[model samples]
Each structure stands twice: as structure tokens, then as C-alpha cells.
Target: MGRARCWRHRSPRRWKQFHEGCVPCQAVGVASHDGYKRGDDTVMVDGGVGDSDESGLRSIDLATLSGVLRVCDVELLLLDGNGPRAAFASRVHEEALFCSISCGFHCRGRFMLPPDWAMLGYLHATDETLSWCHGVPLTPGMALTVMPEGISEFTLSPGTHMTLMLVPVARVQRKLTELSLRSTPPAGQALSLFNLASETTPLAQHYQQLHVQLGQGASLQPEETEKLLHEHVQALLGAGAADRPGCSRARRTHYLIAQRAENFMRLNLRRNIYMNEICDAAGVSERGLRYAFEDLFGTSPNRYLSMLRLCAACRSLSMADSSRRSVKAIALSCGLWDLSRFADNYRKVFGELPRDTLMRAPAQIGQPA
Candidate 1:
């Protein structure tokens, strides 16, 4: 493949024109022959295969896949050898931004959002037990999540598909005011998971339909998009008012312990990590730490750490300029000093030698590959 190019919106008028002209739908249709079926019943078109400007779907590499809504420090660690293939489709409207994402591998990642924006996410398709957010296992009918602002973590199983909308906090507040509803908490509050199984309000049903349409690669006009955003904001406010309970206490505790340990692991990724240090950082006993890791990631702490380092190394190799970097340097940088052992383990997880990844052309950072 040739070097990928970034999509730049030179001006608002031009960007608006591009989206208003049904360009995204056309792009997806044009690439339909190259499309693949995802578990969610959505088809993902590989539009990023070449330098086509009109292509809406873009292949995402781990090194270049930023946050779903905005640019942030996104660290995606692959859980298996599926080798990092994702496709993204996005549309910008007057009131919000709509995104559909399909991943071909099981992976976990974390990202932070800006305070000005709030996100509503729907799991379009995934296995019942494989998708998780903030340590809570997600179910199909459990539908929506009002993502918190500071940081959100998720684990997506292979073939997991999601549809998300990012709207400005000001817009949500305006909708609430128009509807004569009470003001919501700031965007930086804790996440609120809403279940649609027991009671499906009109607004909730509308939001679900819109999410489904977007996931199926259908583009909406500006007015329709605005209406959808309004209904979603109303639904969120209504859900907030309902006396819905949060996650169980045990689950919450496990999430906190795992999150603390994971944060420390990320900070010290370039050096040796000790279990005692992790336990101390998480303020938990060694057994407690082990239980947290197993509950959250389905792996022992040591094994998860090793996978994290290997994933970091894989991303580095994919993005590094091989002309000036060597496999040894990358391995050592990720704290893997045993060259022979590192190579064997890396191949076992990634299905390729580290040097082979480095030799391939790197995708353009911050752009679709």
C-alpha cells in the first residue's frame, strides 16, 4: 500500500457541502464490492486501501486510531493475534457527529474526552459476554451508555460493532431547556449506563433507530441529524431522572483495582514491572490484585502485562521509521531485554516477527490507513 493521506476539512462551507451531497453514502456504495460483513450485521467497506478522496470508510491501524470522538491518548492493546484491523465511518452534522466503528480483533483501550463534549454509545453488535465498559459486562438490549468525560475504558471483542454520537454539552443543555427538563450534571461526571430492555421510551426508541440507521451506512440529512441529536439528549436526561441502579459494588471495586494497576503499568511500560509494585499501587493485596485482573481481563496480572508490552512494541514497530530504527531498539525500548525470548513470544501473539512488521510501510499517523 502507498502512504496514506489525512482528510482535512479546509473550510466549514466546503465540509458542509461535502457531507450534504451524500458523499459518504456514495463512498460506501462504491466500495461495496470490497465490503466485509461484521458480526453486527453491518458491512464494512475497505475504503482506505488506496488514495481515494471520496471513500468514506477508512481502515484503522492501532498506531493511527485515535479516540472515537476526538484526539486523545488512546492506547489499544490487542488481546489476540487478530493483528489490528478496524474500519471507521463518520459524519458531521449541525448538532452532532455520528460515528460507526467495526473492529476485527479483541482489544482493550482507554481514552479521555474533552469537557465540552459528551458521548452516547450503542453497542450495535457483539457477543454478550465479550464487550465491557468500565468493567461492566454489556448486554445487547442494555443499549446506551453516557460516557464520562475524564477517561473511559472499554474492551471490545472480535467483530464487535458500535455506533456513537458525540454532541456538545451546550447542545444537550439547550435541548433539556427547551424540553423544560432539569439541567444535567457536567460532562465530566461518572458514566451512566441505561438499560432499554424493561422500558423503551419514545425518545429511546428513536435513538435506537437512528443508531441502527447509522450503523447500516445510511446517511441522514442535516435536519434529521439535528432531530436525532435532540431526541438522544432528551432520552439521556430522562434516563438520568429514573431511579436506575449502578453496577454492583463488587464489580465496581474490581474495576477500581484493575484501573489503578493498569494506570501504573502504562506509566512504567518502558521498564521492568513487579507484581508487588502493582499491588502496592493498587492498594490491594497480591491475591486481590490477581482476582481483579482475572475478573476484568480474564488473565493473570503477569500475563496481561506481558501482552501489554508486546502490543506496545507492535504499535511502535508499525509506526516507526524502519530506516532509522531497528527491531532490537524497539524491543529494548518496551523493556524486553531478552531478544530471543521476546521474538518467540511476539510471534506467538502477533503471528509475525517483529522485524517483519518494521519492514512494512507504516501507515500515516492520525489518518486512515
Candidate 2:
């Protein structure tokens, strides 16, 4: 068995960002001595820069398959060779968005998205190849996005290096409102409620166009680009989250803990919350509090607090007379210090801009009959 060379990222900042954004982002510095084994399966491996001299990256060997359905941000930078392949699948447990740019790589993979989302995909490749499905063929350089009833499939070949990003839209909107002080505008203001697949509005189309144009240009700065893309992602998540109603189901233990945490946050979202403070209030150790929050909400204490503030902001947006009070003031009251981020998150989660949410009169909460 010949040893494969390892690949590790040399830049520290980039490495840090990659790890923070995609936990378990490991760089195999180089692939092991064994070259591509004919049979091996690993769903994910640590991320690294281009391959180094001494080691080759690990392959997703077909022998052992491990997958976990959880909310995450994943970025894969691969230098592919001949006869390489990776296959992924999920049902009801994931809402995944993938973007593949094949400078000179190829393979095939498929994906399934949660309902209420029209599948949106962007695939860029060197050779003119196509993915034909649902009675349509997506040509190279031409992006293929589908909103299948429930799921979709994908394929890649050797020399196919791509980036795939996935987000459960249904959960996105809820987290958006939870994270920022903004309300989703009424139906009239929203261009359209999310259906699986159809022509998008002019405004939505424009965003995609601009993004593509910028991606092709060399003048666009990576930092600025990442910031903008991150905002777009946040907005997408928000739109995804808004499809569901709030605080519906509740359990005894989970309810009490969530309610207590939420109430405590409501009282102090305007102020920065410390993890220890939350633990002290919940009568649990810091680790215990952190674990509970992640288990119940799929987020950390700080993240949950931010979401609470956003939730309060959403409630207030519909209740308070926004004509007189500005959204900035509302956000400040909700514990968010950054107006720009608040607005961005507001727009992302609610499917409409913040001003739109405030333009109309406040709404009254429905009373139980």
C-alpha cells in the first residue's frame, strides 16, 4: 500500500474561521501512505488547504458510513483525481443546500430538502456536463435548483471539487426571529410564501444575479464577499424558519427549562448575558446548562439569548405602533447592539425587510375563546 500525501491549511485565520464555522474541520496535512483505497467510506473528514507533499487526504471509504442529522455549516475543498466518489443521503432529518464549483473535478450526489422550500442550487463546472432529473437537464455553467416534493438527488465524478451548504428552512425563520429584533412582514409585503419550485420574483432574482456576477469578478474582496454571503445565508435561514408557528409543543421538563430560560432572557435580552449567569439562574452548572440548551434548542446559551431578543422584537414589531417608534429603538430594547446585523437577521428570518414589518400598524395577539 503506497502512502498518500497529507494536506493541511497553512493560514491560521482561515483555519480558525473554517473550524469555527464548520466544527471538525480537520486538515489531514497529507493523505496516509495508502493511496485511494478501492473501498472506503467516511462521511466527513477534517478540512485542509491544498494537499501537501508527504500525506494524502483520507477518502470517504464505502466500508463504514457515519452520518448525523444536525444543523451545521459545511465547506469542502477537495482536489479530486480519477475514479473518486462520495455519496450522501438523508430523510426528514435535514434541510441541505449545496453549491458545487468544479474547476476540474466530477462525481454525482443527491440531496433532500424539508418541505416549504423550492430547491435552489448553483453548480459550476469546466466540461459541459448535465444533471437530468424531474424531466429537466441542468447544463454546466447553468445552475439547477429544484424543489422536489420532499427530496432530490446529486452526482459528482473524479476531478469534481465542490462546496455544499445546507440549512433547514423551516427552522431558519424561527431562529432568525429568535436571533434578531425584527418581524416578518405581512403576507402582502412578502413576495411569496415558500412553495417547492416556481419562478422567483424579480427582487429575489436580482440578488442571485448580483451574487453570480460578483463571483465571476476578480475585484470582489473575499472578506466583503463572505460578509455579504453570510448575511444572505442568515436571511435564507430566517425565511426558512418563518414557515412554522411559534412555541407550539411543550413538555414538562423541557417546557419548564425552556420557559424559564426564555423568560429570564426576555427580562434581560437588551443586556449581554453571561453563560454563568444563565447557569446560576437555572440552578445548574455551566456545562449542564450548555448541554441542556443545545439539546432543547440546538444552540448555545449566548445564541439562545440572541434568539430570545429577536423573538421579542418580532412580537413587539406586530404589537407596538412602529410609525412612531423606529425599529432601531426596538432592537436596542431587545438587547441587540448592532443595528445592521439586527436588520439583516430580521430580513432573513421574516422573509421581508424590517421597515416593511414596521410600516403597518401593530397587531393584537389573539385571545383564547
Candidate 3:
């Protein structure tokens, strides 16, 4: 479908030439937790999870990241094992002309994402693997996906960061038409240029530049933002899809085993759940356990378990009644002693110090005013 009508521009250069990211000479917004607005259609929020669920599962409020994202549409990426829980932080900038998005979280298990909007995305940095449809892995860096094409699944390593480069649907449609991508007129399918490396490519360089530009938080004209997205789309359309192999049944079996292991791990989040313990519970050999986790979740058993514990701790701190609880007390309950280590891990996963979450709470809840 077409987007809301906006000012038009002559068709820019095709994929060969490179263009720097957007340039915003005038100010349009400010950076704060409340969010910055450029116009009636654009709103950006800088926020994180509001509260924690019973299982210490903290749902990320994507609206805080971008006004355009619906909380119902964005799924909760599960942390399947007995470990820490995590929260996500989103910086959303949705405007009449284009959108710039960045979000990060730490989840130590396999999770599913719903087939939602059609947009081009890049895995700026991840220790995990993202797959769509029949396990067609999306390459890292600046690459485009029809997004909903395959069954989209992702296993985020501890503290994985993802950023998206956005263009208006109008320009996106025009670019798609040039490639003759067979997804029909209005709604197009995810497409890519094959054999493209995520690093050392023009796409990657362009993406990084945009990342910096957005980071600047400068006020911008709609055309300045629109051109960045338009040029990026041109580059994607210029490339062709590479050959990709399908996920095998054997790999699927390992995944099933990994899922089982995750369940066992989740149960032991409050205790030190050793690899050997996980192996016994999942009915797989030690080596098999390692392979399963690496294949399915993209991290070794220990790393994943650590992420679970850290996230769970973050929730406890966020929800702690200041009067009755202390950071050390909460950390201990999460089986995370060694206050120094706990503090370090907390900051790494959550992007804030543990004391910050504790201090941010309403004084009447866990602490006296």
C-alpha cells in the first residue's frame, strides 16, 4: 500500500553511487525520556520496560522506542532457560517522511517474532542468528529482507544491538519496481542481493553513517531524512539474492533438544545450573548440549545462562520496594552475589547501573521517602 502523501523528488541515482546519511540543519526535536516530536505524525521516545511479569519477564514497550510500533504486534522474545531475565531499550524516531530505529536487549534463549511490517533492516551487531521462512539467515550489516517472507526467528546473544534504516513506502515501492521483485505492486516481498558481505560494503558504510546521524539527534527536514532512506533502498535493489540452504531435519532435532535444555535452565535460574546438569536434564551428551545451544541460540551454554540471570535481576531491581529491599538483597535472591560483578553485568545488559533502577522507584514502594 502507498504511504501518506508527501513532497516528491526526482528519482535519485541508482545503486552504483554512494550517498552519506541524512543531514538535519534545522532542529525539530529534543532528546528526553518523554520523547521528541518533529510533527503530528512523528514521535520519538527513549524508554524501557515498565514492569516485570511473574516469571521476571519484562516486556519492552516499543512505543517508547517509536510511536509507529504497536506493543501488541511486537512479540516478547522468550528467554527459555532457568536464568536471568532482561529488559529492552528503544530509541524511536518516526516521522512523516522516514523512520530511524534502534533497540537492544539481552535474551538467552530461542524466541519467535511475528511476521509484521515490511521494512529493510540491518543487524548492526549481534552475537546471535536471525532467520526467516525456512531458516534463510539474514546477513549482518546493511541488508534488506521482505521481513515477513520466512518464519522469522532470532536468538539474541547477551547485549545484542540492532538498528534499522528506513525509507518511505512510496520510494520503497519505486525501488522494488526497478528490480522487478515479483511481490506484486503495493505489498512487496522481502528481497536481497546474494553473496553480499555485511562488512566492507557500501551498504555497511552507509548504514554506519546513518547511525551516527541519528545519534546526533539534530533537527531535520523531511527531505533530508527521505533521501537517506531512498539511497539505501536503491543500493539494496541493485544487489541480487545469493544462494541459501534450507534448514535440515537434523538441525531441527538439535533445536528441539536445545529447547528442552532451555526449560531445564529456566528452572535453575536461582541456582548455579551447571552444563552437566543441563546435559542430564535435556537427555543430551555434554558435547551435544554445546552444539545444540550454539546452533539454535547462538551462544555457549554459560553465556546464555548468564544473560537470563542478569535480566531477572534487572526486573527485581526495577520492581523492588525500596523500604523493604536493597540492591544487594535483590542480587542475592537472583543468585548473583559478588556485588561488583553483579553491578558490572547489570550495567552491560540493561545500559544502566543497578542503583539507578533501584533509585528510580517511587519512594513509598520499596524505600521510605
Candidate 4:
């Protein structure tokens, strides 16, 4: 991995003014609007720079892929012990936000979309049968959805490349009204997955090209952005009308069971949690729980739970105050009590000991001596 560097253009007043008038910036809580130019064929940004020369994409390597976007609440757990090494980049347009992500390892997570905004995802590449959303397999030509005010679960295989666009619900609805199309369904409806090959293939291809151009440091004019947004909304609604497949009953059951168990583990990470407790919380027998986990996550319950604890410990250590916090405390808090074993496992998963991560944390400001 190349060294990580962050550059800040400290014009707070200018940024504030820009944020006030830019809906996308406000929606995604962008701190600054500084632009990046292609340097040495790598996409460099104001805050972080991507080091990969092959892709020439500006991406930030994140420890935990949470809070990467202010509009979405994303909690991802790496299924494999390998470091997440998530490559993330985004551009906030006047009426939409576009993002591209490529993960280096298998992972699963639940994401809650911002209220009043709809997220459209296109899988640029993925391993066969390894990418899924809410128990439905994802393919290259399918349109992914997490409707406004909706929460969904997803899993990504190693080396998965995805493109995402987030547009406000009101804007899409207005476009539908103008085009004499149906408005969006009421909130809380299950998200729809539809193939985009027939009528909407050109739109999908166009969107992918636009994303590539933007990632390569091309700028979009105001009218051009507006037209792109209109076309995207139209494509989304058209896909909805085409043949779509709903999540099967068996898959939905397994997903819910796994989701409940995972939620229980996350909420009670402060102490040791047993399999029986997890099964009870999920309202399933031990055998049923194991089947559900294996079906959804391709792992046993015990292993997945262990991975969760380790990831939680990593996040805590990465964000903890080094002056006041210790690896032992964070490990115990995440239910890893054996200090020696915890250190070994943490190193194996994160490529560093707990103390090393803590040492790298930014020091707290305004401390009293």
C-alpha cells in the first residue's frame, strides 16, 4: 500500500457558502468543495489521495467502512480476517451524489439510506454468486436499490467494484410527474431489484461512462448534471416497471434470522455472548441459527461472531483516545478478555497490534496538562 496523505484547503467561510447553496453538499455534509486534478494518473483529492496507479482512481483506504457518507449509516464487518482496505471515492453533484467503491475482501453490512433520498447501485464487477442484497444475488446488469427511508443488508465478494448514485426522492418524483410516470411507492416498501439489460441498458451504460469520466477528473456543467439526473430518474422508474424478482420466502427468513443474531452480537459486545443467547435473541433453535448464518454469510455462527468482535475492537482502537484508553480496556469491552490471544488475533486481522492502531490515532485537542 502507498503512504496515505491528507491535504486540507482551509477556507471555512468559502466552504460554508458553497455548502449553503449546494443541495448535494448539504445532503451529504461535505466539509469542503476543493477540486482535484489528475496527478501522475492517480485521482488526488483535498483530504486523501489514492495511491493505486493501475486504476488511476482517487480513493481513501478506510479502516472501518462506516460514516464514509454522512447521508448513509453504513456498518460493515469484514467476513475474512483480511483488512477491509476499502477503496472509496465520491463526487457531490448539484442534485445527486455519485460514489465508487472497490473492496479488497469479503464483507457484509447493513446500510440505512438517508430519509427522502433514494440510492441506486450498479455492480461493475463481482465474483460469481458472491454478491447479494437482502438475500438476492447481484449481477453485473442488475439495478440495486435502497429506497428512501429504507434499510437493507448487503454482502460483497473480494474485488467487488460498485457504482452508486443517491438522488432525492422529491426530485425523482418531480421528474416522474413531468414524464407522466408513476410516483415512488410509499416509504418502507421492500426494495426492488430489476435487470437493466433490455430497454435501460443504454442508460446504465451511459451512467457508468459518466462515473468513469467524473472519477478521471472531468467536470460536469450545471445543465449537463441536470440532464443526467433526469435520465437516471427515468431509467430507475422504467426498470421498476419491467420484470422484477422479489426476495424468496426462504431467503427472507434466513436474512431476518441472521440480521437478528448479528444485531444481538453488536449490541452486547461488552461481554461474552453465548450461542444459546444469540439463538434465543433470534428466536430460533441452535441448529436453525447455524443454518441461517451459513446460508447468508458462508460461515458458522461462532466464527462470524468472533470476526464481529475483532472488527469492533479495531474500530474502537482506531478511534480511541490514546492518552486515556488502553488496548486491554478496548479488548475487554469488545469481549476479547484474553490479552495475549486478543493481541495475536488483532494483528492477524488488522495487520497491527492494538497499541499500534491507538498510537496512530489523532491526539485530542484542548487537553489540560
- Which candidate wins on lDDT? 4
Per-residue alpha-carbon lDDT of candidate 1 for residues 68-133, written as tens digits (9 for 90 to 100): 443234678876665656666555555566766767677887665554566776665676556777
Best TM-score among the predictions, by candidate number = 4
Cα lDDT of all candidates, in order? 0.63, 0.38, 0.48, 0.64
Compare candidates 1 and 3 on lDDT and give the better one.
Answer: 1
TM-score of 3: 0.50
| Residue runs of model 2 more than 4 Å from their true location after superposition | 1-257, 362-369
> For residues 1-369, what per-residue lDDT tens digits would candidate 3 score against the true structure?
111122212123310111111211111122334433444323343343434444323434211221222211222233433223333222323432233333234332221222333455555654426332223343445354443233233445444434454334455565556556633322243444233465667666655655555545544444544555555555655554342224577676676676577668767776777778899888989889888777665677887677656766665665567668998888877778688998886665555688887777546443322
Candidate 1 lDDT score relative to the true structure: 0.63
Where does model 4 exceed 4 Å of error? 1-64, 185-190, 198-200, 221-224, 240-242, 363-369
Clashing pairs in 1: none
Decreasing lDDT order of the candidates: 4, 1, 3, 2
Off by over 4 Å in 3: 1-34, 40-119, 123-162, 165-208, 219-257, 267-277, 280-283, 291-303, 319-356, 362-369
